[model samples]
Target: MSNFDIRDLLDHAAAAEPAQPAPASADEKEPRLSPLAERMAALPVRPTYSPVIITGAARLADIAVVLATGYAALAIYIAPNHGYPLSYLGLLPVFALATVAALQAAGLYHIGAMRSVLTQAFRVLASWSVIFLLALAALFFTKTSEEYSRVWLLGWYVSGLAGLFLVRLALGLAVTRLTRAGRLDRRTVIVGGGEAAERLIEALAAQRDTGVRICGFFDDRSDDRSPNVLAGYPKLGTVDDLVTFARRTQVDLIIFTLPITAEARILQMLRKLWVLPTDIRLAAHMSQLRLRPRAYSYIGSVPVLDVFDKPIADWDLVLKWLFDKLVGTILLVLLSPLLLLTALAVKLDSPGPVLFRQKRYGFNNELIEVFKFRSMYVDQSDATAARLVTKGDPRVTRVGRIIRKTSLDELPQLFNVVLKGNLSLVGPRPHALHAKAENRLYDKVVDGYFARHKVKPGITGWAQINGWRGETDTEEKIQRRVEHDLFYIENWSVLFDLVILLKTPLALLKSENAY
Candidate 1:
């Protein structure tokens, strides 16, 4: 296993150059993963939540508290005044949003804010008071104070403060509980070894509440140069193996301890590691190239340069997930009749099940069973998709031919998005493991093909909408598809997803390439 050569990623990048992976370990007969490596890959990991999710939750809770308190004050105080201006109702959401903005500016939204209950309380109180003061000053300057009730304002402010305290207390307890359960910690691994790695480790250790838990090291150098163990963490494997480990375990962060001056090695490492969907950072504590303060982001007290971050992560992931579930359910319900008709067509046209399940690569190289309306004969079904359906292919049934062209065959992938949650409604299309273009595997025919896997695959995608869908029989066809996929990933947004989805039906009308 140690003697086997690693895959030369550079060759693939150099122009879709043909290459083969190193031979498998003799006993295990595994090409990429060995027996021990497979076991290590399956090592249990504690749950890790995004720090943004925690802070965002705090902001939402704070906003809710303020809004609810203001409304309650309005209901209680309005009777005494016989009736205050109806315009005051419009001020509620604005005030709540402003309060959250103030808290965020005061750093109350930081993940570490709840680490100390007293400190959090003080910060929240100070920021909330300041926002109220500002609001009062604004009302006075605008000469609108006469229209509003001082008594109502006082009640609102005081009650809002009390509500904030309660919410913060609950938030603090939740953070404390997560901390105790070790669910808040990010499982991290250092990408280099030796003195640089030690310095980075020590710097991280000096800081509190960083939530960074070092797992091990990975360096390509021999044991003499980069020791097998450094600073109490074992050298897990080489950078080549780090990719596999990250894919299997879903590691959160990969910090490179190599000096910034090692540009060549850093670039090389990135060429290989960029395929994994993890935050890749460079430790800059020892670097002399100083940038502006805003250019650097800190994890605890350790400043680092962010090279690459997990895409559609944190809040964006939350939004996308919510979009998928809510919109997916509505679409599924609305399209139920169409889906049933398609199922019946397949059932009557062939003596096979209505849904065809096939394993395809998903996020981070995980295999997922994608459901589609069975389009081909049962005896002639291509589960591995070794041979892609071609125009007028003999294997396709009468029902399959029409559905495949119209994309009705793919409607069942909504089950994948809504139920399985492994796929997005709009992203790169997933392909079979052995899917080929020009008789070569896609990875061999397109440079940086796996980089598309950085995000979850979709039923419909930027490529599909832009005329890259359907058969990928030639290298040019697959290459163009991958290029569009990468472009969508780089410029992903909710709006972009919606635009692609809107164009999907139109794209299906022009099925020149589809089998």
Candidate 2:
């Protein structure tokens, strides 16, 4: 029988009591009645994982193995007959890329495929064989086959294949161990409860190897309409409670079990949830309507329609973090003299600390202390920025004015990027916790204002480079900044970051809105 059929029976038999009594208010210590659940059901839900870095590490390991295997084979052959030309080494990178590409195309990198050692070993062998044939063909077409040692070429092919197989086998074993311990599993939650949600839960349960643990379910309906327990899963609370739960628990994926035909309902739900930094999918397995083949992604055999994807996910997050550290560190060293001079200037010009630490909204709406070179007089400084900095403000010191206008005061935040791992070199600019525009909180001015915190705040951002930097005195200024920040998050790439970095200096030269 199917997994759902089995669960259906088990859940029905075990439905004697509610999973855990509905959460009670602080005044009442004991578990409360369904009234609490009903109250939460009326409230709005918010839309919201950690980036899966394991896959990125695996990819890097495979690439290293490929390179090492090629070089090892070449060395083995060269040791017998003096040395070969350095030109042969140039092919190592090309070979590595080709093998990885081939493996990816073969779906060997898919989580399901990586679960089995035998399956992965076969895929690795096939990918390496394809790379070898392509390399041989290229040599033949160029009529340069005889230039290199035939023994080395053949030996490298065999050694590379063996190396790839061994690597996959080891990884497969490690992943199995991690999965059993729940360390490698993705923490997922289901939205909507009832038959559709139960079906999705059952489908997920069948694929034990997929490593997705369904935490619970969230539905807008009261417990009477939507049972407190469905298919062995508890109804955590209503959609509103889901937002708080997701934030507190670090939820990775939020899967909506509602059908696609409920477009208005789905859209409304999305409006609430999109502000979160999590993968949101609409379960499409139970839908009678068919979509384009490319439109659906599978969680095991069950299909899900992609709604919104977390920005800079998985391997992309890894690459961005590495880029931030490497580039941020280099910039720190190169600008050390200027940093020291600025410190001295700030110290001499103002009778206060050189650095200013202000609490700003960071990734996932958490607060982080952001560092900056202090530019205002100690007595007159506005740590919370309750009052906006205006043109020729009396609070500014002599050196502070120069640094603030020239954007040199932001240099200390580079250390934030390199050290804290909270800031990226390129992302939305972090706003002070109580930062205001036009005498109003930013969240009041713009809907989904917190969405910008989905990614780590940056030292420099797309908005800043596009002339949205400096004082956000007007509501429109903050709104425009949020719009730009959203755009950058939606279309992030390593190349895009470099482009923004390149244009920042020119943008800072204008100082259009700086006081």
TM per candidate: 0.90, 0.82
For model 1, residues 1-515, the per-residue Cα lDDT tens digits are 01111122222223321122234577631235433344445656656787789988888898889889998898898755665456788889889889888887887887678867788789888988898888889999999888788988899989998999888888888888888777788778898888989989888888888988776678888747687557765665678778877877758899998988899999999998898888999998888899987888988888899999989998899888988888888889999999999998899998989999999999988899999999999999999999888888999999999999899999999999999899889999999988999899898898678999999999899888888888999999899999999899989998898898888889999998887
Q: Which has the greatest lDDT?
A: 1
| CA displacement after TM-score superposition, residue 339 of candidate 1 (Å) | 1.1
Residue 129 of model 1 has an lDDT of: 84
lDDT (tens digit, per residue) of candidate 2 on 1-515: 00122234335435433334455688742235233233333334232122146555667888898889878888887755767567688888988888778888987776556779988887787778878888889999999887777888888887877778887887788766665555655667798988899888888888755567665677887756578777876676666666656554466789999878889988888887888899898899899998887889977778888888888887787789889999999999999999999999999886889999888889988778889999888888887878888899999988888999999999999989998988999999989867889899898899889899889999889999888998998999999999999999999999999999999999999896987
At residue 455, give the lDDT of candidate 1.
Answer: 93
For candidate 2, the TM-score is 0.82
